[model samples]
Target: MKRKIFAGLAIRELREARGLTQLDLARRIGVSPSYMSQIEANQRSLSGTVIIELARVLRVDVSAFSSDDGVRLAATLREVLGDPTFGGLDMTQQELKNAALHAPKMARALVDLHRIYRRVEERYRSLDDALRASDGTVGSHQSAFEEVRDYFHFIGNYVDPLDRAAESLADRIGARSEDSLSRLSHHLETIHGISVSRHSTADGGGFVSTLDRARRTLLLNDSLPQATLAFAVARHLATLTLSDEIDAVVQAASFRGSDASAVCAATLANYFAGSLLMPYQQFAEEARRMQHDIERLATQFGVSIEQVCHRLSTLQRPGNEGIPIYFLRVDRAGNITKRHSATRLQFARYGGACPIWNIHEAFETPDRFLVQVAEMPDGDQYLSVAHAITKGGGRFDAARLRYAIGFGCELAYANEFVYSDVIDTRKSSAAVKIGVSCRLCDRSDCRQRATPPFDRRVTVDPDQRNIVPYQLG
Candidate 1:
């Protein structure tokens, strides 16, 4: 079916573009001139054998000729039929197709334009980042994973399993209170015999480390209220239930021999801690009631903003599922350190995101929120909404970093989110043109690019017009 579409179109385009008579292309492809004319008119269709023969002779994609897009292309081509000034045009559909065929640039330009326009109007997410992430290189994958880990570090310097756990506890108690952290700390030191302390003298970030081999005490240097409780809860879980699990993760990840074992152990410990708190079934329910509102849950449950954000990142639990989320913590410079994904999103690990994305824009707006129904390169679309989150720990003297968390999905799941209704889904299908990155993007007209991709050159300009010097060539 597709083959017939492209082949018929191809034959017509090639014959018409060069002003070729039926005899012209027939001799070229070794088919009878009459046969060529019939194919052009779609009175007969090209077989695979003929399809390849035409491509070999015409230098075009065989699939390009037989694609479903060809029918659309034909309809689009029909728009040109209304062109009264297309002089002396007694051309059949086959003749127009011949032009599309021989003039390869025209065929690609029209089809590419249609695809891009559909993306704009339709609102799709770009898959170029995902493709780049999947590049088969060891350094690339590790670099990405390290970026993920580092992103986690920047968020709170420790994953507070207590966020998920404490949220569940608050729901069970039928109350949401701001004093939950103090309540939690008292519950731990008094009820569970867990120890909590603050070492304000350290590098002044957050992370809970129990050097059972050396220091008998759990060391939490974040020295903040929520960090203290989170530290106590994580220490309790690791020292009590998850020690064996942590060992397993160490052995299983082959991290035991590497110095990164401690990091892996702590990371897995954080995961287990979050699992203990959220426990899948209970937290997933409240998450729905809270509408996945991070700050409200943090306030009600007495967890920190970063803690709620981190727990949200873990709703990826098996069996009792939850809304997919992507979480990240970045410095003001757009350096992302800890990022977690339960969605299809593949963010840039080493640098800032597309400036057009809402995360960066959130910084400018500060407390204001925004949503975008976005489309990507693979013909897939998603809705993205972001907000800026800060961590100065209720202390004015404390140093803080501004970060943004964006959680969204492929468009099919838009109805599942609160922000989806906040934005108009009925807008006209016009694409917001964006590239993966200038150095990695293939967009030719992008004025925002600072560099060009490796294989493509800067489309050099002889005349001054656009301020941006780089263009895809």
Candidate 2:
């Protein structure tokens, strides 16, 4: 077998990112300047020894050079093109890949343009209140938020360098126990010279967290769960310690607007926080041992169920990868408030989620986990579990937020999930048929379909008696 070489362009990117000239890097790797130039230009492949040496000199993970940036860009562009608004555009996957590989800058520009178009369409064309919320006067902020979500989705929700840093931070804080809040608090107070304060919504007026730089005090919402409170502290610590690393990733992303850039910056900080709370290797092992049970994982880590689910989706660190899961959160109205997928499954980007999805039923059965074996029109099956998570409203008059969280992986990995115990994995036909959304679904016989598929035709017969008012063809 021919030994696979890492991306020469990626090596060059890392070299330049480290401010090392060709001769400087060549000297560090014990190679000739000409050889280094040839390797960067893809004229000559770097040997295994040199790749290891390059990583040592660059002070970066080997995966930095291993990944094909073009492939990543192509995947993101393909998802961008998959937007329903661009439904009629005739483009092949190969063409999209070529465009991304050969003209990456143009590909990025196209993505930015498409995002702008989507915001415009949502604002001007739709009359719904949700549309107003997503594309109101604060359109740019919403677009930036959506862009950040897509960024995580395309990258498989894992950031190796930040994850490693968080792991190291956890070790430094001596947070070996499942209850890490006290250790984390000690580290923040002693090592970082920051004081932690507590307040409630009734007292703080709904502020979750506030950092006073001058006073070196961190005010946290007392009403928050212990896990959430610890998360706030961890996130603040990450912001203080990992600013440069997080900023570096955000800068490398080349976000088109400052809003997007800021959102990404905050997201990377959160990544660090999540990694710190659930150190990758240990968390991945526990997840596998527990058969990927989110609730059990929550108890083991002393975190919230939602936090456990979110962290599960981010376990895609190359050699230590865990189960790839897709997570979705929706409001009572079926609007997708949060979505990220490590699987091939893509959520709807334009409108509400499909009503047939079990996530909607979660609201009716609050605090109860509902499991389903759902299959898409493309024949891809998933074992999804959902439950309604209520927040706040502790008092009689206080406001509450109710949202359903759903997550799952493909049926091929069904045996690994605890929710799959009740599912008959032997019968593929038993999966509940679902779709991305009403506008994209094409099941003519679906009794729950709310609208005709965008690409299909529908016939209405006044005299016809059926479950629906019209027949889809």
Candidate 3:
């Protein structure tokens, strides 16, 4: 099925930004002014050819008109509305989707207000605990983190200026060469007059890397893997070399506080470091040749498997875009530590993931990749791959961190993935039914549901019971 593009607001904003009138854009894209007006008014859907031409004329990626934001927003709205407080409203899916598409700002404002309400409610409930612990107040760190996360999420997770700058720097520093690590160290020492040194675990104070600006020295943990060492160096270099680009992004974001701004800056710097290490064009081409085999990409780029998966999610480079993959990292407790999706498979923002998803199962088997074909309640199928990664704990006294890294694309593009060959994509029966989370899920017969659907009434029978204790009505 083809997706209908109703990107009138986005197109109008871009045209105005570029100082182009409707008639001017119409003439440029070989369409009549009246037709362009309809497109802007969202009275007509944009065809594939027209979308491409509009992208070319507007100097934006074709994905600018994608329905991803609308879909993600609608899903979030659905989850928000699933709360029992809104049960009396009885909103429909189409109405929520229209709100997402046509009144996005208002929809976002509602989501934000709901988030604030949730936070306040949580804090209120925990006030007694906080008083007993003498903590005084709940911190705003999570709020700042979410603000930064959503900034990247809404922008499609691609920072073009920083990415290009990193790519250029990579070429200059010979990022693809075997001696890249040495080259990076040399570049920092020579160009920035900063000396790099490795320290034992005890001397490094449990930190992976630390910069002493006054002494012009960088201290790296000796226990870290070579890949991590290189990444640390590259990240520092990005902060030094791409400060202007990073600042521009931070300034444009208008984050709520200095904390969010600082977090966004660090994240953008890390993004630049990843781009510097992988070099977008070269990495994308090699990824295609290797069938996106995470192990091979990790080996080729001298990076960790987790890094490879994360980088794969950021390959949304306009006309040269790679497969739209969703990547996430989960700890042993099933809390998602990292997440990004260029696909329609958005993860739950407020709770744990579906228990039936293979990512949670990845913890059972170490040092191996697990693949699954999953069908969401929305009927979208995906080919997912998950692998567990253990980091740190090189010494007996040090603690080890275990996380499962998962990444996948839709089944339509499953053939492009190496893991897809082992699964029968054609068999609908093979696809395990899953949902984002139990609270917002509408699946009535799932025995593995940890919680009842929020929007549904539960029926308890004294006569009999099924695998699940209560039936959803």
Best by TM-score: 3
* Ranking 1 against 2 by lDDT, winner: 2
Error of 1 at 211 (Å): 8.6
The models' CA-based lDDT, in order, is 0.55, 0.80, 0.88
* Residue 382 Cα positional deviation in candidate 2, in Å, after optimal superposition: 0.7
Write candidate 3's Cα lDDT for 1-473 as tens digits.
87787899899999999999999999999999999999988788889999999999999888789878988888778878776667635678889888988899999888888877776676668756456545533646677788898888888899999889889988887875445677899999999999999987664246888989999999888887888888899999988878888999999998868888999999998998889889999999999999999999989998889888989999988778999999999999999999999998988887789999999999999878999998999899999999999988667777788999889999999999999989899999999999999987889989999989887789999899888999988
Instruction: Please estimate how well model 2 matches the true structure, expressed as its whole-model Cα lDDT.
Output: 0.80
Sliding window of 10 residues with minimal summed lDDT for model 3 = 128-137
How would the candidate models be sorted by lDDT, starting from the highest?
A: 3, 2, 1
**Residue runs of model 3 more than 4 Å from their true location after superposition:** 17-34, 56-61, 128-137, 203-205
Look at candidate 2 and tell me the lDDT of residue 166.
90
What would the per-residue lDDT of candidate 1 be over residues 139-214, giving only the tens digit for each residue?
Answer: 3334334533633432323233434543455455332345544554555556456555556643554444443433
- Candidate 3 achieves a global lDDT of 0.88
Candidate 3: the clashing residue pairs are none
lDDT of 2 by residue, 1-473 (tens): 33345366677788888898999999999999999988877667667788789889998766566534555566567656666577646576668756764466799788778888888776676566455565544467788898888787656788889999998987877563567777888898998899988877654255668999899999888776778878888889888988888888888877778998999988888888888999988889989999988888888887888888989989988756788898989999888888888776778776788788899999999968999988988677899899999876445655688899999998889888889998787787678899887766768878988877766667999888788788876
Best by lDDT: 3
After superposition, the stretches of candidate 1 with alpha carbons farther than 4 Å from their true spots are: 1-187, 190-192, 195-228, 428-435
